[model samples]
Target: MDETASPVESADCRAISEVLSRVGDKWTMQVVVTLSDGPRRFNDLKRRVEGISQQMLTRTLKALERDGMVKRTVCATTPPQVEYDLTALGRSLAEPARRLAQWVRGHLGIIHANRRQYDSRR
Candidate 1:
């Protein structure tokens, strides 16, 4: 907390920080973007996400579900089938996430060059 900051500002900052910590996570962003298309089964999502392990996918879905950003449904079948979809809140986040991804893609070359330059200087 800054010496001159009011309590309300501090509380707001804390709230923003907490939300950002979740939303800014790489897996969370990727999962949200993937689910933006529509609902997907566990194995399908795992395949589409690429590189994410089954355990990590499970954890990410659980976290999103807990945050009210995703809905999980279990279908009736011989073997229960589970699907994950974005909630309204998750859908709301999709646009901004897409924009951020676009921005990152646009800047990736420059970012890599900057990183390389900085690393070489060190």
Candidate 2:
């Protein structure tokens, strides 16, 4: 009898890849990081995340909600208040994102120096 098993695709692998694709988007990580702090209103998020247009923010938040990383709540008020908060799974990513942010902060000088050197050569 043959002992070796054939290489095969698996459902788990596809699911994980799909999830990574969603979270790996440019705005997704930033949005996740922003919401990790606490619940925030739509306008507040747009204001806090620099360079994000209102449409882009709305789309990113909707995608996060579809991915089960964010929870949107509507509060009863005169104009209807909406807020976003991270789900448990989303909150779990805080440590990793924090580490990434810290690493970026630490290495930004090197990055800027490299950019300056590269741009000067161009």
Candidate 3:
């Protein structure tokens, strides 16, 4: 019997890769996290996710909206206000994202030590 993991072209491999490719993007997770609290206006999101540029936030929110993970609402007002929140799918994803966040926090010290060791060897 032959035993080996499937190549990237395999259906499962490709699917997992596609999912991770989007989820692993730095901005996506931050966007999801910030929106988890409740609907937030554009400026609010920009402020909460520090270091993110206006252009990047717009692009990330758009991408998340396209993926069905976020809902964007525009209200008519003096100038118009837009708010963002997680859709059902996005909230579901947040559970895992939150878990991952906790895991990173818990393991940060060990992770940093490992990185130092690896870097020092080279």
Clashes of each: 0, 0, 0
Residues 1-122, model 3: lDDT tens digits = 12465564477777888878888889899889888889999999999998999999999999899989999999999799998999999998888888999999999999999999999999
**Lowest summed lDDT over 10 consecutive residues: which window, candidate 1?**
42-51
Candidate 3 regions exceeding 4 Å error are: 1-9
lDDT of each: 0.94, 0.87, 0.89
In angstroms, the error of model 3 at 2 is 11
Q: How close is candidate 3 to the true structure, as a TM-score?
A: 0.88
lDDT by residue (tens digit), candidate 1, 1-122: 79799999999999999989999988899899999999999999988897899999989999999999999999999799999999999999999999999999999999999999999999
Q: Measured by C-alpha RMSD in angstroms, how accurate is candidate 3?
A: 3.0
Compare candidates 2 and 3 on TM-score and give the better one: 3
**Top model number, TM-score:** 1
What digit string (tens of lDDT, one per residue) describes model 2 on residues 54-104? 999999999888878899999999899999999998888766877888999
What 10-residue stretch in candidate 3 is worst by lDDT? 1-10
Task: Estimate TM-scores for all models.
Answer: 0.94, 0.78, 0.88
* Pairs that clash in candidate 3: none
